[model samples]
Target: MNVRTHILRRNNTGGIFHQRGVAALLLVLLVGISATVVTLGTMSYVRGSQKSQLTVHGQTQAEINAWSGAEALGQYLNGIEVETVTTAMDDIVFSRDNQTIASAQYKPDCSQTSRDLYCFDVNGISAGHNSNLEVVYQIPIIRDVSYTEISNPIVIKGDTEVTGGGMAYLSSDSIDGFAVDGNLTITNATKSIASGCATGNIHVNGGGVEDNGHLYSSNGDITLEGLNLVGADIWGGNINVLAGSGFHFKSIKAVKNLKVTNAGNFKSDFIHANAVSFALEGQLGETLVHSDIAFGNGKSHLDYLEAGGNLIFHQDDQSHVPEFTRNSKIAGKILLRTGEDGNTLSTHYNSTFKNIEQGRTATDPGVPEWPECNVDATPFDVNTLISQANYIFYIDESDKPMLKIQNVKRASDDKSIDATINLSSEGGMNTAYLHNKPFFQCEWDSKSCITSKSNSTDGWVFEGVTHFPPGVILFAGKGNPNQRNLAPMNFTLASKSEKVGPLLNTILVTGDITLGRGGGRKEIHAPYFSSPDAVCDGDFYPANLCDKSSGSWQFEGKWDGDRVERNYPVANTSIMVNHTMTSEGWSLEGSVIVGDTFKTDSNLTNVHGVVVIGLNSDEGGMKITQGGIVVDFMDLDSNFLNIPTGNTQVTDESTLGIPTAMWARYY
Candidate 1:
């Protein structure tokens, strides 16, 4: 019985051990499953975090790229034409190393005629986007005028007939050509019509009435009092020659009607009129006259007449317009109605219409549409540009100031600049100030160091500036008083033509520039014994010192570092006679501009470069007494604006320092 109990105990013990081992195994399995689930969750979290970081980085890069594109666009659009941008531009792609990434679109607001509005849209990596874009406007401030293409003869607008018995004379001092932007009327029998003239059709938006360029106008009745038709053509409206007024030269045509009463000595190949009425002793030319209404009531003869309406040559009881031979001994040819048949022509006193040519009266050479004026394509207003300069000067206003230019340069592809500046008023150390005394060094009888002891300008060197950016306007002041006849001031040019072109020497005078008087009245009395204003008020210098012969500017261009090469003053070598230049000499080598008048009545004026007249000081604009003005018109081919835009490079900005505006207008 003892042996059996022991065996049972051992068996029981073995069963217990087995049960404990199974429990341990189960626990280990549970722990292992929990660890696996936690690891899997952690791995998933890490991946999600990485994705979020990557997205943030991409958004930052896109924002940077969008701004970079905006910077580049500002430069590219500068100096670009409005029409070109409107046509060729769409969506713009921004690039890095030529690899395009960001894209931007442009929308222009063409509402304001004077300016443009630009808008841009850029998509970024981030969810945010911009609809409002920065706007930049490129504006030009001024432009020079161009004179080309001469009009044909018989150009008449309104009643452009000068009829006076006092006789009109053709003077060499007359303007070569005159363009009026509005209606023109010269009823002065003593008035001499010298040059060809043009007028605008409409009298409003395009109307800027000026007797400018000796010959250019826009619209209105160009009536005449005493007609002196030289080699000129009158273009405008109605033409009327009342009572005994005569045309001695070439062509008189009108878009309206031409009425001639006792006119004299008019010779031409062509004359077009809406209606022509001639009475009494009117001398006709060996030319063609086309009119809507043709009537020669008194003794007005016509060579070849083309009348659109009734044609009548009534003398006493006879009623029919007459025609004559081409080589007739009379002053003019016979009349032929433009719309009337040449076969139905008749004349008084048994005169015949047999000598006229049948083929010459086919179609009337029609006049150009009214206001046949041409406009320059430059993108700036001249008056506004001049007024906005950083430095503005009026020569001859206080005194004829001097200019000593150092240099001019194009600092970038879009900008041209000049760094060297030595204006006469701010004449630097060692430069000769000739405004007061060009003949002497320093002030008149003094040995002070205020001015250089020597009168030589050979060693004058330019001082270069690095900091000042390019394209900065430098306006010389207009001085204390407005620039009137610049009597006391005289300029001395140190010619550096090989170095600098005939440009205003870092100095520009805004007013009239009268160099010398006609006879001998040209002098500026400012002796150095007293204060500047006091001396001028004190009235120094010889009374006749301001004589026309004495008002010549001095030139020391060829100063060979020691002595001036010559004592005589050169007109246009190193000096540009700014503003209106009135002088006695016959030759002008450099550029000249007249704000009021360019009167060279002393002799014939020969201009090498540009000769522009903003205004005429004379009864007309310019009066060249004898030699007949000869202009090289080629002088107009260069960058006409002589304003000093300091020559300095702005490297970082792509604008080349050109002016730009954000144009406060928003989307």
Candidate 2:
């Protein structure tokens, strides 16, 4: 029974062992499956992390590249035009494939035209990016090359060549001439002579010589400067030159016309021409004339004849200038006259004075005529004639005293007054009257007192009051009073070639006029007049004078013995035009005509040209009848301000990058 139980147990034990082995195997399999699953999940997590990291890196690189491109584009745009950061940063892409990125231009929210806005972006790491781009950059678009064609004449500073047929010759360089219809200037060029055969004009200033040695201009004006014409003949319609302006003519023989203008205070010694007309405008410093001179068909005065040839002066038209004629000779006629007015004046041959009476004209019967009146030894000194006077004359309230006559003595040929007369006087009247004849009187007032004589007889006749006009005036003290004591007066001058009427006007200077009460109430015109009571007391020059008392100015008239005080010095109501004066450094008021030849310095840094033309409430403003011009001393072929803007683009060719341009404007 024991043996049977043992076998059964052994069998049971073997079965249990088998069962345990199976269970173990199944546990191992399940554990292995769970481990495999964990491993797979970890692997998957790691792969996803790597992919995200790669994408982030790519995006960062793209951002860096985009930012770098933005900076480069900003720097590039900096050189072209005014651009704002806000307007230069949008839509910016960084890609190696397209290699191009443009930032979105921003417009200011304020709608300001003067300002711009901008934005920026990256493209290399965008959603649709497909580039193997290590980096991408953006740069500004720069204009490198350009081409232009000018239909009209183009003036350049350096040199320009024209392949087409056109006239381009001036005083400076070579010219190519066709049917030239425009003005051509070739100044200061070396290899500039081309070919042009048109009727156009050309002005060459300074070219050595042409390879062909020929200059031709039909129906055109030609001027050459600084040139030596050895045997060259310039067949131009008209020509002009100055002696010192680099022009040397073997002999200027023209078939049309010639004009020579001298500016260096020198004269042209030789001039031989064959023209229907000739014009010579020059300043006669110290020149000798070898040809007969003719005057324009106008009134003129002949003073002397001392040239080598017979100085024949005649009147003719501009087309018939005698000096240009081949058979012209010298003839002489001279005359000299003395008087403020041209008519009723004393001629050199006559001594007696003549007066203008009615329409008929007659000379003084007592004076000599022609050759008899030529008294070379006669002594007539303007200064010594008025040195010893005897009259103490005072006008209204004038501090400056006029001549006073003491004792009158009639000589055989000239009248003389006693040499003892006091010239210094203030405001008071003469306490003791010594000589009170029917022609003399003395009066006194609060502001003025005068001692004078007034009569139609031989005595001093105080008539036609001396009035001070309202205008700019010059005052010269007692010493050397006649030099520039007054502004220039308008005087008619009749010259041989032209007759220029009164060119200027006179200004009145009041010495003792005072304004009414209250210190600042006095109104004084500056720069021209002096105020004896204001800041510049009626006296100007040497210092600014101030007027102490203010009172309305009044005019006063007085002669040798007749004195009238408290009268306003009224100006003559004659026909006189107003003046327009432009004040540069000084003030010039009132109405007056301005001469056309006014000068102003443009290069003077601190000097100002102040011109005041026309006055308020004046009858007429200053009239600019003719010219206000500036003619430079440069050669006719050279223009100071006619240079072209090279290529119409900025270039690094020169330091300034472009040729200087010349311009002129009228305001």
The model with the greatest lDDT is 1
What is the clash count for each candidate, in the order shown?
87, 86
What lDDT is reached at residue 42 by model 2? 7
**Runs in model 1 with CA error above 4 Å?**
1-194, 200-217, 223-232, 241-250, 281-303, 317-321, 324-368, 375-475, 478-507, 510-587, 594-606, 615-667
Distance from true location, Cα of 229 in model 1, Å: 4.4
- Look at candidate 1 and tell me the lDDT of residue 66: 41
Each model's Cα RMSD: 26.7, 40.9
**After best superposition, candidate 2 residue 220: deviation in angstroms?**
6.6
How many pairs of residues in model 1 come into backbone collision? 87
Tens digits of per-residue lDDT, candidate 2, 435-479, equal 221222212111112224321121222121121112222211243
Model 1 C-alpha RMSD vs. true structure (Å) is 26.7
Which lDDT value does model 1 have at 184? 35
